[model samples]
Target: MEPINLDKIAFQITLHGGNSKDLAYDALKAAKEGDFDKAENLLEEADKEFNEGHKVHSKALRSDDKENRIVPTLLLLHAKDHLMAARSEITLIKELIELHKKID
Candidate 1:
């Protein structure tokens, strides 16, 4: 297999992660406004973005496994941070949406 482009993978992860977070926040806003349909749609989009990021991350892991070593870098760290944050935000937002529904 061709050598993996770590930089590209990092950027892709960051991009998807950031998008997921943004969409999740937007979903929360929609829920707050009592637009549950829109909120659900936004959450779906967020899931898609999160999945894309995860796929890239998995590819990187596979590459590392094949090489039998891990390469740590600042960009990769930042990308991972974004992914984790997005995941957390998505979970929290889903719960908040449910709460909003109950309160509404």
Candidate 2:
């Protein structure tokens, strides 16, 4: 019956978000070059990282950290930004895959 630390959760989430964004960027680059398989592989890796970040978020929601939150910082905002970017990239990747399929 203990609560998780908000600072730690934010740190882990930020790391995962950054990694996922990097993978997604690589996926987009590969897709643009017509390397569909490489793109798919990169996207898969991004999905794994994103899922990890999501787990951290879920932990925060389940714990008492949400209600006891103190000051708001920019780094936490940056983490949210990174997560949004990753999700947007995921959507774009799906579109790219569909486009490639159409071209084939």
User: Which digits, one per residue and each the tens of the lDDT, describe model 2 over residues 42-92?
Assistant: 989999999999888776665545566534457666666777777887878
Where is model 1 more than 4 Å wrong at Cα?
66-70
For residues 1-104, what per-residue lDDT tens digits would candidate 1 score against the true structure? 57777789899999999999999999999999999999999999999999999999997887786555668789999999999999999999999999999999
Off-target runs (Cα >4 Å) in candidate 2 are 1-3, 65-74, 100-104
In candidate 1, how many Å is residue 100 off?
0.7
Total clashes in model 1, counting residue pairs 3 or more apart in sequence or in different chains: 0
lDDT for residue 74 in candidate 2, whole number 0-100: 74
What C-alpha lDDT does candidate 2 achieve relative to the native structure? 0.77
